[model samples]
Target: MTDQPTTESKGQDGPAVVADGLTKVYDGFVAVDHLDLTIERGEVFGIVGPNGAGKTTTILMLLGLTEPTDGSARVLGMDPARDSLRIKSRVGYLPDEVGFYDDLSARANLRYAAELNRVPKAEIDSRMDQLLESVGLSGTADKRVSEFSRGMRQRLGVAEALIKNPEVLILDEPTVNIDPEGVRELLDLVQRLRSESGITVVLASHLLHQVEQVCDRLGIFVSGRMAAVGTVAELAAGIEKGHTFEVEVAARAIDAVTLMELVPGVRSATLDGERIVVTADRDVRPEIVELLADNGLGLLGLSTSTVDLDSIYHTYFTGAVNHDNVNA
Candidate 1:
C-alpha cells in the first residue's frame, strides 16, 4: 500500500538481463504484458508460475526465440531479437522438451551442435568431453540418444546445450522429466557452471523449493503478468502488517485476559485451543514473553511463520492457476 522504492541489491557485474514494457500477444490473447525485470549478472534467476502464466513467453523473448509485441529486451547488452546469432553464441538454452535423432549417438549429436556453432575442430573433442562429464554422460557418449532412458536423454540435452560454454543459460524445467537423483545432479551442475564460469542462469519452473534453493532472485507470473519479483526475503517483506501482536491464552489461565489488557499495544486478546497463533505488524515476541512471565502463565509454545511465495501467487491469480504448492 505504501509507495516505497525497492532497496534490493545487485552486485557489481550489472544486470545480465533487462526488460522494459515487454509484451507478447497471440492474436487477441496476451501471453505477456508490460513486464519489467532486471536480472543481475552471475546470479541464478528463476521464473515461476502456473501452466499458462507467460513464464515461457518471457524466456523466449529473452532468448530471441520469439519477438515481443511491444517494448524491448536486452540480454548481456545485446538486443536478443535483433542480435539473436550474437546472443546465441554466448547463451546456452535447454527447451522444456529436447528432441534428438534416434539413430545418432550422443557424441554425434553434440558434435553436430558444436559444428553448427562453429566451434573449432581441434576444440570440439575437448569441449564435448568436458560437457558430457559435467552432465554425467561421459560413459554414454557413444550410446544412441533414442536408446537412452528418459533420465539419460535429459542429461544429453543438458550437455548439448552447453557445447559452446555459453555465458548465460536458459533452462525450461531442466529437472522436470528426471527423477529426484537426476534433479540433484542437474541443479548441482548449474551451480557449478555459475560459480566456475561466472555464467548467469535463467530458470523457469513450477517448483518453488527448487527456486528458493538455487535462485538469488525470482519473479512470479500470474495471468500473463508479473505479480511479484524480488529475492525470497524481499517478497516476504512486501506483505502488510495488520497489528503488532495477537496472543490467545490457555483457557485454564483465567487472568490471561486481564493481564494482556494492561499491556501498551495489546489491542485485542482471545482464547484459542491448546495453542495460540498471532498476527503481528512488528515482531513482539520479546514483549509478549516478558508479560507472560510476570503474569505467572505457563506459555506452552510459540512459533513464527511468514506468508510464502505460494500465498503470494494465489493472491494475484486467485483460483486461475492449478499447480501443486511447494513448501516455503
Candidate 2:
C-alpha cells in the first residue's frame, strides 16, 4: 500500500469511453478484432458474450492492462496507452474474482483500499461508513473478510471500488456465484448508482438475462468480434419478425388476428392460448391497444414480449461474426 502510485486527473467529458477499430492479438492468436464502441456518460452499457468471446480482453485493452495490437481508445477523453494512470484515477474496476486480505476486517480492507487510492484522510472514514451502509454491509464492518459470504465480499468489493468516487465503473461478471437474492440486491445497487449519481457503468458478462435487466444498450460479442451493438429492441428489429407484443381481452376477440395485421410494422398475428401474440418490426403496444378498443374488445392486458435471449444469442452468435445490427 505504501508503494502504490498516486494519480491526479482533471475532469474532461465527451463520451465516457470511445474505441475505434480496437484490436488485440496474442502469440498470433486474435483475441479481439476491429472493435468500435462508444459509451456515453451516465449510461449503463453491457458487453455480452460467452466465455472465450474476448470480452475480458477487450476490457483489458480499454483499461490499458493489455495493449491493443491495432487501433486506439479514449476513456474520459484520455488515451489509455499514454494516460492510463489518469484514466485509472477516474475509473473503477471490479473483476469476477475479487481478492481481499483474509485476516483483515471488512472495514480494515476498505480503509486499505482508500489509502491506496489516496482518498483524503478526513473523508476516508465517512466515505467508508456511507458505502458500507449503501452496500448493506454495515453489520459486517468489523467482521473478518475470511468470515464473510461470497455475496458480502462482492458488496465490499463494490464499496472498495467506489472509495475514490470514480466516474466510470467497469464490472466483469459482477454477479456470478451469489444467491438469487444477492444477485437482485447487487443489480438494484447498479440501478441506484445510475439514477442517483449518474455514474457511467460498463458491465461485461455472459449472463444474458442479467445483462438484459440493467443495460441501456448491449454489444453482442462472438468469436473475438462484436457481432452487433444496440438496445434489445433495436437488435431484435434486425431479425425477421423479431419484435413482438402480447395482448389479452376479456372475451375471445377472433378479430385480433385480423386487427393486429392491419397495424403498421406488424408482420404476423396469431392467438396462442389466452393471448394474442403479435410479431412486429417495432413496439406496437399503443397501436395494438387502440386497435383492440376500436373493435369493442376490452383490453385485459398488454405487454411487449421479448424474444428468448438464448434464441437471440444463437441467431447472432456466429463464426462469421458479422452483424449490421433489442427492447430489453
Winner by lDDT: 2
**Clashes by residue pair, model 1:** 243-281
Candidate 1 has its poorest 10 consecutive residues by lDDT at: 1-10
* Residue-by-residue lDDT tens digits, candidate 1, 103-155: 99999999999998899999999889888887888898898888898778877
What does candidate 1 score in Cα RMSD to the true structure?
8.6
lDDT of 2 by residue, 1-328 (tens): 1121212232455889899999999999998988888888888999998888898998888889999999999999999999998888879888778889999999999999899889999989988988999999998899999999988889899998888888888988888888888889999999988777778889998887887889999888887877888888777665544566788888775667887889999878899988988777677888988987888889988887755676567667753222553222
Note the clash tally of each candidate: 1, 7
**Full-model lDDT for every candidate:** 0.75, 0.83
| 276: Cα error in model 1, Å | 8.1
List the candidate 2 regions with Cα displacement exceeding 4 Å: 1-11, 241-306, 319-322, 325-328
What would the TM-scores of all predictions be? 0.76, 0.76
Candidate 1 overall lDDT versus native: 0.75
